[model samples]
Target: MTTTLPHFEPFSPDALAHRGGALAEGPVALGSAGYTILNFELATTVLRDSRFQNAALKLMEDFGITDGPVHEFRAHSLLMAEGRRHLRLRTPLARFMGPATVENIRGILREIIQDLAAALDPSAPVDFHGGIDQRLPARVYCYLAGAPVEDAAKVARLSERTLSLLNRDPSLTPVIVAAYDELFAYLRDLVARKRAQGLGEDMLSFLIAQHDAGKLSEEELFNEAAAMLEASSVNTTHQTGLVVWTLLRDREVWQRLVEDPALIPAAMVEVLRLYPRPGVVSRIATEDVELNGTVIPAGSDVHVAVWSANRDPARFENPAEFVLERERNQPLTFSTGSHNCLGQGLAKVEMEEVVRYLVEHFPNTVVVEEGTDIGQAGGRWLVKSLTVDLKP
Candidate 1:
């Protein structure tokens, strides 16, 4: 027998913080949307368990994308894959996004940051979110996909529109559907052009090579490319902005980071823990599963409240404060287990490089609070506008 789970609305402002203060209430809660795992321990268990599959397909269906190319892609994409097939789909992409490849790309990241920074006027406050964070990830994606640099803006637009399904706005179904159609067409053209122009060492070229080698079918190849493109930008853009916004506002941390550039990575991780972009990782319980004292029925939706878990006192000491030197400071920002974010290494390195550039070039950068707007929606933190004064 199980008692009733308390009602909780995760998207409510300061909900995670409020829930953090009420941990003794239990680790799980029921909401209008679904069941939420509010503690670190249970959240990790649910994330790693194969019984809880990704809710992306369900999310699409809920938006009226029950059949067609977008539906088919989501149903068979890597996010919905399991076991060996998941590994098979993940391995090729992982080689390029893992630590070693990302490290080699660090120099390129620095160059890109420098170039973007060069466009800003140091004497005035600049729109950091618009000018830098929003633009960098798509440029990096272009480099990875072997797409033309001129296509960065278009790539950014496509990514933003396609992944906007996460916003949970039912009215945007048409936009999301059209975006996928455009994306599929763009990828088909890009792939055909790559084959015509001869293959290279870039990721898209490598995927094309794999297809030729009979490792991936035509549809699987397109699905993989679409997955990579859709995921490559929007979240990373907001996260990079969040990192910059958090670090610049904390003068003490900013000074320390400027003094010792070596602390950049740890400091970035601390920021990630506090302000994760993906606040909730939604999943569907494939079978009746008991978590804690509650037996979740089969096909129930489970929302892993990452923001709440990251701040749960049982997991992090001084759960609300920023502690840069905290040992084993691992947050579920990129998640865990086999299905964890494949591009996390690349995302982190991109942010670190951006921070590294600021610390090295403009040590006195500060957030222009009046011009900045940071807020949360659907339980996810997003940078609406971030202005910074780089007193170079």
Candidate 2:
């Protein structure tokens, strides 16, 4: 309800605090790239509007996932699908990652978090990103995907490689291709094993059943499973680091949550708002549409600056600051519309549990540095590292 000037960098957090509110006034055209809608209201409309299609293929081409095993692997991604095909692929996977699934595996995930927390040495500085944040989500998703938990380290490495291919660098194309092959092969074999051994209650098994029912082809099943790993592993892993950084940076906020654990859920939402993993969510305008007095031609690529929108004054009071109990707080972190993140519920459970465990265990945590993997193509900003000193 409070208005503030946009003083932060054009797309940076600081810019969001000061200039974000202005977005509600209108949208801006970014040269040939397309229109960028920063206003909360406009962005919401753009995302939910069926006219703006998911430019998955455009993004893939832009990121160089054009051909090879990686392309084949991504061909059936729920992220890339449209119409009934998107629903067909998304439905079973969504059911697997739905709220019930998260709740069912909550206890198992708690054990994973507790184990990671227990391993942290209070007397030393820990690479919280690698030691816990990264490990926790990867392991949790691995468990959910019915993959081998013991192979988490390997899967994490492969997930990184698979995501990095999105960079679209020519030199790294071969490396990216190899990584995709290795990952696809790994999941393919695992799917085969699950089939031979009989599917279980896990997500991978659910997809396998869908395959058996002739609802999905075997290749689609494998691609979706791989996509699940790539999708779930990367965003959750990096976002966890960002969430931890947000908490540790504001010592008072950290202390408050530690003192009252009930605040964790709300606090997590706020953290996600300020540091949504994917800074920008894009779509292609299916028709020439007039928005906020601007005419967007048909087939024009459009982007929503999520980071800026989350801080729009029109949406939240004191959008820059991390307020745990902000009323009517609905950050576009998980995005909106049909293509919104399906695994958000699971992400919430994972983040809430991991964050609470960290603050509770490492009460005296201090952030030494925040690391982001450079040159990642537009989606989630990868927090490659976060060094934090822990206390007894």
Candidate 3:
């Protein structure tokens, strides 16, 4: 009763402080009508599972999942699907697309870095973060999935717009919906081409064969790839931006890495912990649950507040500090249990190699202010651009 949203966007540090450990505003009324947010006692019980009946994809309608033909097009991807449907696609997806594969292909990941490096104009102002954030994942998506490189810029643009609405404006659902559709259509073409010519080294080819192997279906193939790119690639892009920012500001962190290259892998996870790309977790409850005299009712929406929980004073001492050497310091940047991000390992590999290459080549990465402000808009904090003076 004491707080109001839009005034306080949940999962932010401010809201967590005011609401007393990230509790939802309660099963209170949304004014006038009988619209009420669900009463949630425990946040994880709902999202820590896909078993709850409330995990239904249709449940998106009651909450903030946007609606539109274009939006609906994206609804079938793995991010939106749960239960048996999710298992069907994700099972095979986990097989070939696992973390080991990403790490093993460090050579390709390095090549991707070299491509970004070549695009740099150290003298000319450029938002290194924005360019790489957009370029890396988009290129990764198209390349790994066997899509067209020509489409990377457009896919990157639409991907950024779609995810921007995730944390804030529910009203902008329409625009987000259109972006989803545009991205899907683009992926669909790539899937078809890969199926036709049989590009055997990449994921798309693997997927095409997997379907023929009874691991995936025609629908599963489409949904999985679209889901793969949209769900997996986007976060890597955001993390690329954030980790770069963290490195530039913390000169000591980079200097340490310069002294020891093997430490880059550990440093990557530290950056992931320090500044999570999503920066928040949102979930909706499926059943009544009781904890600490609070009852989170069935169907109530909840934001899991991983940002706060991972930084919980009880769980981690000095939760805000970036400590690369902290033992047992696994950040919840990727949620836990079943719904944990499937692409997390790939993200780590990509970020580690890129930062390693840059630090080795430049010795120092400093921010350039002019290139970073051009496209700053919305609830987006990932990177508009990052201009850093670097020695080549």
Name the candidate that leads on lDDT: 1
lDDT score of model 1?
0.91
Superposed Cα deviation of residue 16, candidate 3 (Å)? 7.5
Candidate 1: RMSD over Cα atoms?
A: 1.2
C-alpha-based local distance difference test score of model 2? 0.75
Q: Distance from true position, residue 237, model 1, in Å? A: 0.4
* Candidate 1 residue spans exceeding 4 A from truth: 17-22
What is the Cα-based lDDT of residue 111 in candidate 1?
86
TM-score, candidate 3, is: 0.82
User: Candidate 2 vs candidate 3: which has greater lDDT?
Assistant: 2
> What's model 3's overall lDDT?
0.63
Q: Candidate 2 on 1-392: residue-level lDDT in tens?
A: 22222222233323333345444334454534556777688889988888888776676666666876667666657776778888888888777777777788778988998887777776777777778877887788778778888988877878777766544355676676787788877887898898899889888898888888999897888878888777767778888887878887898888898899899889889989887877777789889887766677798888787877888887888888878779988888898988899889988888888777776776777787533232224444557678788773
List clashing residue pairs in candidate 2: 5-18, 6-18, 6-19, 7-18, 8-14, 8-15, 9-15
RMSD of each: 1.2, 4.3, 4.9
Alpha-carbon TM-score of each model against the true structure? 0.98, 0.89, 0.82
Q: Any runs in candidate 2 off by more than 4 Å, and if so which?
A: 1-19, 23-25, 63-65, 165-171, 369-380
